[model samples]
Target chain A: MGRAIRQAPGRAPRTTRSLAHARFLLALTLAVVGLVLIVMLAVTIGPANVSLAQVSGSILGHLGLGATGTDSGAVPLLIDSIVWELRLPRVLTAAIVGAGLAVSGAVMQSVTRNPLADPYLLGLSSGASLGAVCVVILGVGFALPAAAFLGALAALFATLSIARVGGTITPARAVLAGLAIAQLAGAGTSFIIFWSAKGDSYREILNWLLGSVAGATWNSVIISGTALALVGTGVVLAATRLDAFAFGDTAAASLGINVNATRWALLGSVALLTGAMVAVSGAIGFVGLILPHLVRGLSGPSHRRLLPLVAVCGALFLVVADTLARTIFDPRELPVGIITAFIGVPVFIVLIKRKKSSAWS
Target chain B: MVVAVPGSTAGVVIENLSFSIDEQVILAGVSASVAAGTVTGLLGPNGAGKSTLLRLVGGLATPASGSVTLGGDEIGAMPRREAARRIALLEQNTAPSVDLSVEDVVLLGRIPHRTRLLGTFGGDDDRAVAAESLAAVGAGELVDRMWHTLSGGQQQRVQIARALAQRPSLLLLDEPTNHLDVSAQLSLLSQVGGLGTTAIMALHDLNLAAAFCDHILLLQDGKLVAAGTPAEVLVPEIIGEVYGVECDIIEHPRDGHPVIVFSAPRTAVAPMRAAASA
Candidate 1:
């Protein structure tokens, strides 16, 4: 190593790095502000006619802040029930699930060194679906969230064991194993649906499979929020070590990282976060897969720069998508996954068409 | 500026090193010592464990048995980060999954220097070192470019800059000139030779090795066949026996460096056209 003492950056490259940093900060700030506005807008636009002031008042009243209303009185009980009881938890769940899935996707891609990887790449979604199907169709008595979370964990363990069959788990082997398990679980889910799904239960299973935040309560908010706060933060904090992986495992090892240990830790964290999101939202698509790629063009590929913005963009994206899901069809709600896929496929095509993007190169 | 000093406390010593995979022996009972602040060329044909030896020496892989000591301290005993702070390896094959900017790639070299748990982002000093390393490798102008946008030769230079940014005392490179044009190959070697750090590079070209290396270790089937100065090791007798080719040694016109000129294999078969048709 050169001098152990640090030196100030030279004039030229300092400006360049800081400029990128400033851009990242600006994007993050904009995304956060957008998320807050969208959440408020989403809270007000539900089937129940609620104004933005009423929504804010309800939230403030519940937060123990003095409820300042247009009529100089407390917000109406009906408005409070609609906003706080009905819409707020749903929006919050969507946002938390979005952020968690996006961060998980970013970490997954980096750890596996695959551009196409997502949080559910390890068969978490298929496993969760199989669990939820059993609960809804077969009338299994386990709580829906518990069953789904356990199913996801089981899938993770199975995939990892298969990958570890002959030797240490490699990214290629894990991915392949995950694919195999996904297929098996997917077939199992299909078989259950085909064999036993009744009339009303079909709609229920379909809704869960397609993912919805319509049933989100404060409990959903708490579950997804705590997971994001814990695992998402750790993944973001490991950004530099993630960057060490850009040149492959040997290069990362030479840079002093324990390649296998770091990979396992990161993969485990991503699985936990993804499992939490899946348990709540039932495999909401596109936010995890598309959000990181969408923001990578703006934030660049460094996880330190890309992850925060991806989380924010993801939250904003899902909140908007969920709002559109409920309101666009008005009274009849589409699953949020349908909206995400509808939006995600087009955006993904556009991103792919922009072949000059160095992020993909 | 401080003169380039040996980053480790002393030279590296290897004793009876052995490595294998899947019950297949790769290297067996190989031993050598490398003096500090010198460039040594590790010369061998394909499958001779040259890459494996570099990985072992750089502490990227553990030897099945035996020890490699750097500056008298065993490498395997050191924490990964401590070993990384003293050594850097440039592997022959590596490609980023994402399209990273050249600066982002080079800044990764500063990871080991960070002490804080949350020090994930690079500070000003890292950018400076990255820039300095780029300039050192003559890739300063390429910093803003994306890694995938660079030509093969440019990419090689940037990769070298990333390694230089680590400012390692012991630099190990596997075939540093693999896919470069002649000019690029020359420039890259010259740049590496001027770094003043102790370096061990695997090379295929005898002439380049002879010109740039201070010492040479020749291997055959993962065993050291010869170890000496380039003049001592690159003689026709040893080259013919190991490489199975007829070759003549001639001194360079300008520098008097030994250059090997190959004529043909000792027992040449029919040409490729007839052989392939058969």
Candidate 2:
């Protein structure tokens, strides 16, 4: 019986398991390298046409590694200002926001057990937007991110309360509750905008609404970057617990996870991450909604291999998308949201039409 | 059969357990004990609270008024993780929405055994255990197949593999054979019978229960109607009263287990008046 068990018919050979593990590792390493390359290449592609070498030299020089060329003294002040002061922060912010949103989306989908669930599925983006618009329009002295984070927490509480029926939350109820909250928050934002806007403030609010990294500063980079690193690390560490949920709530509970508590904590953390990204970049779309599915197509549904890769790919995607958004329109400068929608909608359709069997039913 | 050694912790003992949802009592004061290493069939009709009773014993739900003890330890007082290490429950019709390979699904059984959050949960040892479990369920060859692609019987087999991977001392299954064919159902119960673990299985098939279960606990309307060896519990009178149908009980020629055969309802109505007029 032992020998028969060992030689069971459909079990993949030991070699295959190792090979799959190796494949995941290879994919992860490639994504990391790709992210680094994209970030490097993106910083060099803005309107001023800063050469790759100068971009590299300026980055190295800032790190106290000394400039690459002998004529370091002759480096133009304008190029330095453009590279260090303008483009680098914006690109970095875009990358971080992308990563944050994608990770949030992946976590949300797993928690809700819904394929269509995105980071904003719980009305997070709308809540954050409401907070931001209140700040921008009402001239509130509070920082926009603080207000946005609070708004997101409020919306999460409201959604949870609405979804909860006799102490259990079904996926359908949660989705419907989130949709209702999203619409309510959206209407609130629109009302605030309509009631208050006067002069150039309208342009500022519009820029925020459309989701642009055009105004990204060092502070924006710091805020989004820190949020991604902190919250992203937590999400990756919790991957195993999340994997236990693959079978459903009762199965996860049987596996020793406190299913309800884990779901609530994870949902809260995702909201925090999404709120931070939304506060910084003004509700960029698609990166969160589509990137996880794309990554799952390459790596299987194990969150252990899925989470980190999703984060990196998300960063790579946003950096590339933002680059296109700014460069494609030249001086006019389109918002990154518009660019993501154009690319996202077609890819989503193709994914649907391909009808390949995915982990998501 | 492994008999319960009086004071051993290997058996499950339930005392005066009651549970209700929204004023609808699902199980009321139900009590029974399953011996160590015996396959005890939970026989009941639909809405008879068999599933609810199994959940309470598995600690998936808390009883309203009584207690379940496993080996003398209060199951409700045990830490969920500790309880999980010793007990595994397989619910009916479980199909994960997420796409996962058969191996991955089986590996989920190892979660309670995993000690650290940061380390790899499914290591070589875990994979070996999972493979052994799949092999035990005759599903070893399906380790690479996607879960959604599998037929219902295949999925049930894989789910059994997942439960086996837990290596639980007490296994609870709720209508595990619902999607399986006759042979598959018999084979699965036979496999469980050989595992040397105390198993409580909720089953609708009286014959299958008679053939495989060492003992039978018959339930009706949230209460225990009968509990004993198959011959003692599966009488025609109890079957008639509980199922509202007439039935005959006979000894199986091969195994001497009680075999139940149902007859048509005794109170058949006369020919309809409308049909007579037409």
After superposing candidate 1 on the true structure, give the runs of residues whose Cα lies further than 4 Å from its correct spot.
A1-11, A68-72, A131-150, A153-180, A190-199, A346-361, B1-10, B96-98, B269-278
What's the distance in Å from true for residue A178, model 1?
5.1
Per residue, candidate 2 scores C-alpha lDDT tens digits across A232-253 of: 8888888988888877888888
If scored against the real structure, what TM-score would every candidate get? 0.90, 0.92
> Would you list the C-alpha lDDT of every candidate in the order shown?
0.80, 0.81
Give one digit per residue, the lDDT tens place, for model 2 in B186-259: 77778778667788999999999999999999999999999999888888778878888767787899889989
Give the per-residue lDDT of model 1 (tens digit) for A1-361. Answer: 2321232334366677678878888988999999999999989886678888888888888887866445467898778888887899999999999898888878877886655466555677667777766786678998765666667768877987997756556655666787788778767777787787566655555565668888899999998898889887898788888888888788899999999999988977776777678777877766776888889888988887788889888898889889898989888889998998887768656654654342233
Candidate 1 reaches a DockQ of: 0.40
